[model samples]
Target: MLKKSLISVLCLSLLVPAVSLAETATHAVKPLTAHQERMKTCNADAKGKKGEERKAFMKSCLKGESAAAVKKAPEAKKHEKKTAKKPKTYKKLNSQQMRMKTCNVEAKGKKGAERKAFMKSCLSNK
Candidate 1:
């Protein structure tokens, strides 16, 4: 029974894909929605157009806004080049400098003599 069931499952998996390919080959997938149809038409019309020119043509063609206006706007700033943020540069600190920085942070919000005393104690500790 195990062998038979395994054979049947394998057969089904192979058969299903063959049937799918045959169906696809026989029938073209037509655009069902208005937007999809417009996209299809625009893509066909935008043939031979490259880069931003193709993009502008496709946008105008899809909206039916200005099908004949396949012009590129030089100053439109449509494509902004995103620059990767530079990592924050930190000054390398010696042990004493690091200790002082930590002490200063620990002594935050204290006033006048109290702050001065806390800094003195914090700086004195190993």
Candidate 2:
């Protein structure tokens, strides 16, 4: 009975890994969603663009806008340049950056070891 149980346990251990691998393999190649397909097509079309032009092209293409319209967008932008607003004023900051900024502002008057201790405490509290 001991021999038979040990043999069965080994077989189960071997089969467990095989079954898990098969399950993972089956899930690895899922079909893309409709929106993913659209994005794929738009990305391919906008492959040559860079910076804000690429962003604008991707936005328009994903929104079901005609590629022709987006292609001629540069000319329209030329005319609108006079009325176009300035670039964004505030930058997007992550939590760590915001914490650092606040810490720096608070530690403005301090120097050397004092500033280091203040920053260390401030960073940890946040």
Candidate 3:
């Protein structure tokens, strides 16, 4: 009887990890809401814009902002303070590669093309 009980205990111990893993794997993954899905289409490239253009684009793309929202905003002078920081330098690339990278970054797609394009833009723009 003792041997049988020991075998049962060992079997239960072996099952514990599997049981926990199964439980963890069963969690429901909620899908994105409509608003979130819409926001995802907003140009990730918009981060590259600034000033009135940025405001205009964001306002139009995100829908109009309220008066109260504008009132809480910081003054324009504070926003316009430009430092004479030296421009970034980039490693020189051959023309063909540069074009490929440029096209890739700006092209709409998931994964490799998007990443390559973003990198190309960043590197070439530097």
Output the number of the TM-score-best candidate.
2
Give the root-mean-square deviation of each candidate in angstroms: 11.4, 12.4, 20.3
lDDT of 1 by residue, 44-71 (tens): 8878888877777777777686643545
Q: For model 2, give the RMSD to the true fold.
A: 12.4
Q: State residue 98's C-alpha deviation in candidate 1, in Å.
A: 26
Q: Predictions ranked by TM-score, top down?
A: 2, 1, 3
Off by over 4 Å in 1: 1-31, 72-126
Off by over 4 Å in 3: 32-72, 76-126
Residues 47-107 of candidate 2 have per-residue lDDT tens digits of: 8899878877888899998878888776677779878888879989999999999999999
TM of each candidate vs. truth: 0.37, 0.48, 0.28
Error at 1, model 2, angstroms: 11
Candidate 3 overall lDDT versus native: 0.64
Clashing pairs in model 1? none
Give Cα-based local distance difference scores for all models: 0.79, 0.90, 0.64
- Please rank every candidate by lDDT, starting with the best: 2, 1, 3
Lowest-lDDT window of 10 residues in candidate 1?
A: 73-82
By summed lDDT, the worst window of 10 consecutive residues in model 2 runs over 70-79
